[model samples]
Target: MDDKSATFVVEGEGCEEDVLKWYYHGRSGRPNKNSGELSSKVKKYLSIKGWVFRYALKNGKKELQYQSPHGEVYNSLRMACKSYIDQGLGEGRMGNVDPKQPKKRKCLSIENQPLLKSVQSESPERRNKLKKQENRVVKTSKRVREGPVSSRNPRTVLSLLIDNNVVPMLGNVYYRNKTGPPLMKGRITRDGIQCHCCSKVFTLTAFEDHAGSTNHRPAANIILDDGTGRSLSDCQRQVSDSMKSTTTTLRTRSVVEIPKTVKAANSIRDENDGVCSACCGGGDLICCDYCPSSFHMKCIGLKEVPDGDWFCPYCCCGICGIGYVRDRSFRSCHQCELKFHGDCLNSKKPSEMKTEKNTLLLCSQNCERIFYGLQKLTGKPILVGNNLTWTLLTPDHRAHGGHGMKSSAKKENQCKLRAALEVMHECFEPSESVETGRDLIEDVIFGQVSKLKRLNFRGFYTVILEENGDLVSVATLRVYDNKVAEMPLVATRFKHRRRGMCRVLVDELEKNLVKLGVEKLVLPAVSTTLETWTNNFGFSCIPDDERSKLVQYSLLEFQGTITCQKLLK
Candidate 1:
């Protein structure tokens, strides 16, 4: 019977009777309404007692709702276990299997092998049917080959596909969407593998692989008219543009010329005792551009041409900076404002000149301005370019935020830019020395006056003005880290004073500090010189109480003022 019919029949039967019923209210054929209710109560009581039911009330509303059959079985087992536990009953050695453990399927024995084989074997009819299916596949493939083919050969088919709308071209072979300008064509192609537009070679696979080469597509598209497809006028225009771009001369492109070393030695040698031929009056000989004569510019009408480039009287020196000269050869002392022959200046030939923008031709001393200028402009902590050294002087802003300057009343404060001397004094030698060179004077120098004597030594630079040329002031700085950098020592010669050399020195040092990501500068000085921080320079001071004990003694006593400025440039 169907499930619905079964449910109706089950519902018609009242629950089996239990002993000691109180009511006989219903007719004899009919079940007492309380009978079903009583049975439900008994079942609930059995549940509390943990007794399992052999059968469920199938026709009950609860039973009609669907639930997992496995869950129902597990519930019945759980109830049985609980009832046994409550009753203190034991079913010893029952071999109750673990519900979680699956039953293993039995394996076939050797005796059953032949029977299994007979069952697996296919009949002859089944084999014949399989053969017929394979034959059908072969026939279908044969019919496909018998179909008509296109008129074009394989190579021609591919070409037409590329030419017509059959297939697409990739990369530099064609322009992008026919927009922009065309690429150059007729580029020297060594073989079919080489690209005519970009002058690059590729394998056949590479060409086929990328399909759209950036190098060739633009050129191809230019040849093929936009939207019109390969128009003759478009091809002509593309060819013209390609020729123009390739042919135009680049400004910095190389030009054929003799090497500098070969030309300088041979061409400038004078036949007449290495004397200049152009400017006849000569003590030391300098070469001329047009001829091979070596004559001194001083002996001739052009004694000292400031910032000028000239050919030697020998006509060997070129108007351009390019030229060759002998060892110990002197073109002219640019700072000296006079031409000095190699023999006279006792100088070695300078390094070959290379042209670049912002290039300075001055000796180390003369280039000080350039170095400091660049430092200020770029905000770089240290300016080290073209053999010049620059460092910036910095004040500590952290410790000296808002303090006023205080100086001793007894001493007249000399506002002479002398701290650069203080720097040089400490940088090179100890604070106490017999005497400092006049060239060491800070704040008043231009170029190197000590000649090239100390070129091998590396040090901070100071320039001094001299009667002959410019003086060179050199010193070293001691570096220390105290939150920010501290410049403990710097030295300059006495003669170089008043040229703003100290400011330049300070500028260079500060540049170094800032470069290291140091924002504060610390230095020690006497309280009497507090105005140097307040009036001359800007730096704020912190109270002694606020300073770290480690550096409190080292901190300067000067009143501080905070000055806003770019330290490195």
Candidate 2:
């Protein structure tokens, strides 16, 4: 090997001084394989300090060889170089490594002298370009200032509960006052101030009682006005365009509203006006036999409907897409072709009619049939195969009653079940998996009907699945309250398959529902369990497609109705 000139370029000034001192003091002998040019003093100092060299050795071929010492020298060197550059000393006559070498003009090495630049003003072109770039950056970030929100809320009795201690309870105002001048029953917010009875500005820190007050139950209407503007027009346009066909169509309909005026004494409510077409009884509310659209009596603006009258304006006689008149002065619906007199329709109070003009009222069932028919046609079986366990983070000790606790458990279980299903599919063939099971239909049945009943709205006893001692499967029932109890979710562990545990769980749930005042038992069965639901459990299977539309539960009303003659005894 030929003797070569050894060079070193320090990163920062501090590192430079240390390196120079170490080099000069470490080397004492003529450089050799055993004892290199490192001075004895520096070598001894390093040895005493227990430090070693960490570097990457590169040969003529530039292949890297790893070597480690007490510290990572390369990493330290890079960090020191970054510090030097950050201090803006590179342009001054301070320590700086310039890899670009002049002359041989070859790719230079960092193991050489440092280079610096003199501080001269930038040229006009460069200065102008920098200014333009700065301006462009600033302009891109410009934002329009938003104005404050307008305040114009109405006042009602509920406001009193905010500042005063008033626990709002159902029928609180109705039963308490019973016959006061209809007290204003809303929240107020014209100025920042609000009324005690109606304003909703209850402070979070309020120590006053906020429950059990007559102010809480004042009847207040929640009017959701889609203000007449371009936005409403745009929404209407979107909905209209999204409809299945451009042609106007009448559909099966039911009256969903009950007049709130039943308590007013001497209000001789007409007998024919309140009767339900479906059952002939004077039901305060009525649900459609087809879809999920509800209507109040007043909402239809019905001045009168004669005896035996059935069918709302929306119901098609299945004829000219409108309701038809039944024999003996019965107003029949144009859609669905069901005939009845006006009283059978069970119309709402005239004040509740708020649907936008030009808007068509169709039941949820018809809507689904028209729009999602294809999706339903193509729907397949659920890919099931997984062990799922759900731990309720909500402590079950609180006793929300069995209904609430069981409901929460079921909901959480369903989520966990879904996750487990996805995981199982991921582990197997996901593409071939299908969801032809009860879970999906259960979601719809419980979701749509329960919510309707909860709003103090008019609904009927349909199907209910109640969990029993965590062991029920499937059972029979007649009528079920949509409002009571919660939905139960089915879970499957690896060892629990094929033994009909699901069936057992469902049976238990259904029986328990009956025990807990459930009037009906309902379940959506696939080809696998369709016969089982009907034959074994005594449940009537709602035809598959419409299962998604109408409430699906067999009515097991054993005490048959008898409109016996009031004979002249």
Candidate 3:
């Protein structure tokens, strides 16, 4: 039998009795404003009690709708689980779930049942089917004050059912057929509630003060249309209008981008560096219609200027799946290889969580957590073979009480920092003086220096390669959103030279860099070692034009060094 028929049979015992009771009186059946929320404990308890169907709200995402394992969605856990059992999709296990990123929730007091902000779901046709069956089961309990509720946004809208008409109810008050019972009688459903009225359905445009001037159906529910001419009648206003409306709005639609364009006279702006993303050179450049990236006519192979707006190959917004059209702003994440509009990100995430949005290395909380996870692995030895060990260090490692470090561990980290400082000073002395050179090393390592100098080393990481637990080589590095990285200093203990220790150190650093999405590694190769770098190392000299673009990085440079780069991917 169909689910509707089975539900109405009143089987008088066991599971069927439980389902009937819930259908008649549970939180979802006769909702009093819980915003379709179910407590986590209740969900788990239902699952432990052998309710096979389940739904989960995933974290660190802006996507709509909580979905079950079999891809079904519903308003509550008990109802969803029961539906799955009825449909026979097989049972599911609550295996491993990633910890949810903490977020502040806004709530409303009900004077009855308090409600959190609604979880997203669609009013599937199953709801309508159940509602129709429910009209037969509980005719007296099915009726409620019907109208176009202004305060409640609903998932399913009430519209004329004949010929698939989409226009909705127009007025604030509604009535059922007085003769007896209307045919397409609305009722409570397994998913949500539904209600209907006798007349005044419309196929024209606008809501509230709007006249039916056009046959336009708005993409949003803002404009409810009215085909019937009766705007004024003796309809009494319902007091339920002041209460929170249980109505669902349209099935969730993608956040739309209506690009705020510059005036026609001032279409393209020079806000980004006037250079090609391909060659990183300045010239007569073609700007992306959406983002700040520009490409030169030759570099992009455009023989003629396009007649309309042009977006770069990288103009797609990861959040919306929409490519840049005209005047839209977009930024790409180095880690996820995803592009997002600044406004789209702002709409989903809280404004206080600025680190992920501001940094290219991470575009979401999941990525932010990943980077921190990688950081935690630092200051710990990673073994390579029996003899070699790789260790990473940051300012936090050497800082007192860092991430709640004990005093002894803090002292140990300080000792290691000082030892690495001695080795750096031994290998690369300053052109000016020994003390000045040592000061630069100490400042970069400990972050006790000029703000501008510290900015270059904002996220400074020290890579060390140890042979049999002896520090052999070290490199000082910084990465910017996986776009590019700069290693200002590379040094090997004099005794450890010619043993390929520096190469091993570099290889290890590159492996981690790839994981972090660093695309290229640029080094300021001192003239004495330039040939060795270009030949022994896999680096090529950066052209003068390309070198100019590197100015934005504010990379550290010395008088005798020529810049060299090695692509990571």
CA lDDT of each prediction against the hidden true structure = 0.29, 0.26, 0.45
Which candidate, 2 or 3, has the higher lDDT?
A: 3
Tens digits of per-residue lDDT for model 1, 423-538? 33322222110011123223121111222111111122222111111112333332222133333223333333455555665665565445544445554333433465545755
Q: Is candidate 1 or candidate 3 better by lDDT?
A: 3
**C-alpha positional error of residue 50 in candidate 3 after TM-score superposition, expressed in Å:** 95
At residue 565, candidate 1 shows an lDDT of 24
Q: Put down candidate 3 lDDT per residue, 177-257, tens digits, no spaces.
A: 224432222222211123344232321111211322232221122211233422111110011121113211111111122
Q: Give candidate 1's root-mean-square deviation (CA, Å).
A: 45.3
Clashes of 1: 91
lDDT (tens digit, per residue) of candidate 2 on 490-559: 2232222356655544544444344334343343233333465456546554343332222211111101
Question: RMSD per prediction, one decimal?
Answer: 45.3, 30.8, 34.0
lDDT of 1 at 415: 13
Q: What is the lDDT of residue 164 in candidate 1?
A: 35
